[model samples]
Target: MLESFSNININLKFTIENEKNNSISFLDITIKSQNNCFQAGIYRKPTSTDNIVPHDSCHPQVHKTAAIRYFANRTVTYPLDVISKEKEQKWSEGLIQTTNTIGNLLKPKHNNKNDPYKQSGVYQLICPKCDMIYTGQTGRTLNERLKEHFNDFKHIYRKSKYSTQLLGNKHPIGQINEIMDVVYVGNKGSHLNTMEKFYIYKETTKGNQINDKNTVPTNKLFDVVILQ
Candidate 1:
């Protein structure tokens, strides 16, 4: 069986043992990959396709609540808290995790208009008219960085020495206000600088990006996928 599989560039995994009747039995086979693993069960005997069939009674019967509770108990890294529904009598093992450790049930939720950029990540700002793009990343939240961009526009208006080249007369005026769209690329925290450099390199190669060119160092590696 191993030789047969090898002929087709397929690897077969199993163990064979001699039986009392001068026969061989194949044990279970295991296969592994980067993110997952699989195991094949042993067959009692070699049989033709016509004689082989799946047993209907061989299915596992796992209770949903019991399974949830079992995993919840094992995976409770932080303090575990359960919230029963209002006026509820049934014991619900299904959990709703919260950052709050204080037993406050009525904590008011804040609904900010710009809540999407509350995460630390790499992002892109695109111009509507010329399709020019600016690739950036933030150690803090994206909203904070975006606010800085808006402040740069204000500096441009006041003719500050620190005026942004992103909105100069050479480029599109009021380009910040005419932003076509914003994109959230990835959440690489400390590695934001490297990731941002990677994106800037890629965008500049396309000849439509507004970012000033700089020599990217080849010393670091990042798991970046640029789909053009």
Candidate 2:
């Protein structure tokens, strides 16, 4: 025999299983209607079945569907509150004037408006060991420019292999203890390439008998350029 609620309307069935003691045992179960289909537990003798019966109600199985629905509802409601709070905090902090200045400094200026290269000063370096002349340019103050080079000169050293190899492996600009002479070729808004070439040639060939412009020893290596 089997039992179920009147509204549920489960159908009943029975089967017989032969026991080891020669006595026949009856198995009864219910079938439920599911989407115009039927489903039921398998009919077998309780003694012959080795499978463990589940508890009357498991917490996870009972609550899983409702838990998922609750979390889904919370996800929809909570993200808006989080975003609103974030916006409020950002508004309260406001924008700093120093932040604006820093932003302007980091922004890239297009050469279409004005030539950035022309508005920067040029630098020249002579490797005492190789007699190789290098040219460079910068918009930052001299001390700041030199500090930047010292901080990140490995990248430049890697690129200018010929210059580093010829200079007896000396550190670029700042690492060397000895002071090297530096001359300002020209102010901002000028042909930096021409100015650098002219001054480099002039200084290198001043007392020497090298009359040929092409024969002057120039490394043509640039380490860094810091734009304002």
Runs off by more than 4 Å, candidate 1 = 1-115, 157-163, 170-190, 215-228
Per TM-score, the best of the predicted structures is 1
Tens-digit lDDT string for candidate 1 (52-139)? 1112223454542444454444333322223212211122121323222211211212234555567565667765445677777666
Model 2 residue runs over 4 Å out of place are 1-120, 152-157, 160-180, 191-193, 203-228
lDDT per residue as tens, model 2, 137-196: 556544454454444454555333234433346634433323223344334545544445
Clashing pairs for predicted structure model 1, backbone only: none
lDDT of all predictions, in order shown? 0.45, 0.40
What is candidate 2's TM-score against the reference? 0.27
lDDT for position 140 in model 2: 55
Candidate 2 has its poorest 10 consecutive residues by lDDT at 219-228
